[model samples]
Each structure stands twice: as C-alpha cells, then as structure tokens.
Target: MLSPEADAPLRAAAMTWLTVRSNDGADPLPRHELESFHFEGERVPLIDRQRGIRKPAILEAALSIITVYRAEGTTRPYEDGTGSDGLIRYKWRGLDPDHAENRALRVAMERRLPLIWFVGVAPGWFQPVFPVYVAGEEPQLNQFALAVDEVFGLVEPETHLEAQLRRYVERVTKQRLHQPVFRSTVLRAYTGRCAVCALAHRDLLDAAHIVPDSHERGEASVRNGLALCKLHHSAFDNRYLGVTPDLTVHIRQDILEEQDGPTLLHGLQRRHGQKLMVLPGPRSQYPSKELLEITYRRFLEPA
Candidate 1:
C-alpha cells in the first residue's frame, strides 16, 4: 500500500516502467511517482461479485515484482537471514494441486505468459516487491523458494499489524492473463544508459523495443530491448537506422545521403560503424542475437 517504507522500491520499479520505459507517445498511461501512485493490497484475483466468491491469485498484477517476506520472526536454517528462502512454501487453496486455479499457475509458468511477479506478504501485514521468479512448488508441504536475490524495495500496508511470528502455510499460487512486466527488466538491464550513444540521463533514455511491441517475436524483456535515447529511438523505429546482433550501428543509405544541417550529418548519419555504447554486465541480460537477427531482417535490411 504506498506506505513510507514502500516509497523507494515502488518508485524504483515504477520509474523503470512508467517514466523510463513509458515511450508510448499516443496512449501514454498515468505516470506514477512515489508520492502520487495508486496502491492496493492483494493479487490479481478471480472475483465474481454476484456469486460472493473471492479467490485470489496473481495474474499479471499491475504492481510488478515485489519481494514476499515471511512472518517477521519465524526462523528457518535454510531460509538464510532474510526471513525468506530461495523458494516459497504455500498451501494449495483446496490443498489439492489439481485445482483448476492451481493448474493454471503451472500453465502460466510453462507458457511464460503474464510475466510472473515476486510478490510478498508478511504475517504482520507487510509486503514488498522484487524482480524475481516463481520456481514452482511440490505437493508435499507445498515447499518452495524464490529464485533468491537482493530485494528491490519494501512496501507495507498502511495499517500495521503486529508481526505474526509463527510458521503458517501460505497458499502459493500464480496466474496471469497478460505477459509479465518487461519495462523494468529492460530499463534496469542497461543500468539506465542508452545502448547506442551511452547517454545516462534518466529522463532522456528509454527501454526501446528492438522489435516492435506488436510483433509476435517482440517480448517485453531486456533481451528484446536496448536502452536508447529519444533521438535514436525515433530513428530506429522509422527505419532510419538499426543495430546488428554484434552491436554495430548501421545507417540507411538514404539517411546517410540526406541534405541537411550538421544535425543530419553529425547526428543520425555519423552513427554508422560504431559499436553499441554499453551492454549489460551479465551476458544473459544482453539482447538476444536470435531476436536481434529478427529485427535486423525486419528493419535493418537496406531498401
């Protein structure tokens, strides 16, 4: 719920998605900062108001990627110091793994649809979000763990509850009607630097889609994005230019031959042959070559 403790992490994730990756000029959605953002507790659920049924499951929940914390003082040796393990343990709603909602979570994972969010709810009414994954669970004890990493930030309920310091079986489930949030992943992957010119201005850079968002191949992940500035973003989109999987920038001959002031010559035309300015430190986070090849074939080919 947009509490004081949550301000930093929420804003961080929001900045990555809303401000940083929000390049949708036509249908720009609301921009959220720490101070001015909507806050809600709970996951994307299947609710039938008429039937008086409320079954909660996360389905591409708008609040992306939060860290789930264990009840404040409950202890586990393998859980390490963070009140969390590399996995999470949750009880099935019916305690039956075969429940339709339960099965849907598995399907979501297999299909990799509706980018899964690592949401946390503490026994003491606390919650936080982190960029993590759901590694699935077992029927026995519903035992599981998060992919385990440093949490991005903390979010807590405005009305605090005394920490529930006991081991309780969490009802672990996941479901998504849409793909996962790719904006934060792409923006954070580059550490906020433009891939082409290496510009680091937070407001100036964007998580530019290597493939158009409409294409079936275009995923909303870092592997499908490059941190690009407004200028390169426009150029890249209009087919004024493109980058090879090897990270070489290529200028269309027409743009190269355009008769204009120094802006044309020094700006768009001169970028040819230069290597991409910055790539993610982890090779896995680098834009996918196969995806890049698709983009190159689509927009990089000469007219």
Candidate 2:
C-alpha cells in the first residue's frame, strides 16, 4: 500500500484528469473517457465493468464506485445505493469483509481519502460526482457511508444532530445527486426535445418540475417533469408561460400583447395557445395532468 503522503499527488492528478474530461460535471462522460486516467506514462483504469468498486493497484484506497442503470423495462441486477438518510449506503462487494475491494473502501474511510462516484444516467453514459469520502462503515449491514463533502464525512450517522444534518444533507443531495438523474431521466423520456418549442439540443434543454420541487407532492420522476429549453423553462418558472392539463402552452396575456424584439414576438407571443411541440412517447411517461393543473392554477393567479 502506498503511504498517504505518496498517494496525494496521484489522487490530485486523477481528479484533474476527471475534471477536464467531465467539464467539471456539466457534461456526462462516455465509457472511454471514464475508462482510464493517465499518470506518469502509465494508464490506470477508473472503473471495472464487472464490479461496482474499483481500486487501482498503485493506489492505497478505492478509486471509485459505480451504480449501473437498468433500462425502464428491465430488472436491476443489484440494489442501487441510494441512501434514505441523505448519504449513500454502498454495499460490500460480497459477504467477505477481507475481500480486496471491500478492504480498499475501508482504507478510504480510515484514511479520509476522497473517491469518485460514477452514476449511470443511461446505458453506457455516466454522470460523475467526485471527491466523495467513505465516511463510516456498518459491518452488520455490510455497507459503508458515502458522503458528498468533507462536512458530511465527519458526522456520525444517527447522532443527536442527525435530524438537522439530515435536512442539510438532503438539500445537498438534491443538487449533487437528484438533479442530474432527474434531468437525464426526463430528457430521455422526451427523446431529448423541448416539449414547448421542440428544441432538439440537449445541452440547451432543462427538465422542469410541474409541481415545484418544494411542494409536498413534488416528485423527481418523469411524470412530474417536462423537458423544456432554457428560455421556456425560465418562462414557465416565472409564470410568464403556463401549460394546462391538455398540454396547451399559454403565454401571460400582458406579455403576449407587449411589443418586443423578435425573441418575444416569435418565441413567446407566437407560442401562446399552442399545443406542446413534443411529448414523451409513452403515455405513462407524460407529465402528470394533475400536477400540471396545480401549476397552471398558480400561473393563472394574479401576478
């Protein structure tokens, strides 16, 4: 095992390599980009296709953890580590605590080393969350706690502060975990097109929530989301645009009547009272009409 002092540089280089490839997590990395990291004229793999945990021979601790995605119709091969307590519960590779993979993750926890989490957004497509730490282990449960940041890594699970920390962690989890998955899932259901304007550029589109995420009924699922381009997303969130239960788009009456630039004229005013340009192929994946009615009612309220 490499000493902690010796491992620091390698870890930094690996993180730098990952940052460049992922564009700091704004873009998903393909399998090839995630396959390996270059260090000192040698190639070190970042993940293992057959295993969830990966530990390079040269590193003293685990390098990364992966969560594979099973397509909508298929059964998952393993239980995914989406923790209920706002921290990830990564299962042991097998029943053996002495197993090399499990030991590597344990070493990561003991040493406070940061690791990467590669979550499958789609088949062969991954969204990377890096610098995560193995916070604590639950031997009875055969799992380890994975924290997104240093503060969370230090807190013991189920402490007196647990409730407060959980609330904080939940907020962080929504940003660091939920949103990326939510976006990818929603866009896939809509076939990567904006519902309102049918913009096909994936990067420019957003997964918008029909019932605001703060609401008690808000769910981060495809049925609660609409794929919209950036402009339409902003408009919908601001009540400048609204969509009824029947999937008809409406721009606010005052905005529709205002004389503005071509963008306002063609993009907003022209789209008033039109049906959504695109929708999910499966009826089940369509945005919930009930949720749409809730937001539309809010949109209709005096602004």
Off by over 4 Å in 1: 1-180, 300-303
Question: What are the per-residue Cα lDDT tens digits for candidate 2 across 91-154?
Answer: 8888899999999999988988888888786778887887788878888988888788735654
Best candidate, TM-score: 2
Clash tally, candidates in order = 21, 0
Model 1, range 1-303, lDDT digits (tens) per residue? 234454335434443443332342111222122114333542222222221111223332222322333322344222311123213333333556766545544553343322223322221111122333334455575322233122111211122323341111111111110122344445556777888877888678766888865677864456778878889988888888788888889988888878999977877788888998889877867888888888777674656
TM-score per prediction, in order, is 0.47, 0.86
Q: Residue 14 in model 2: shift from native, Å?
A: 2.1
As a TM-score, model 2 comes out at: 0.86
Model 2 error, position 67 (Å): 0.9
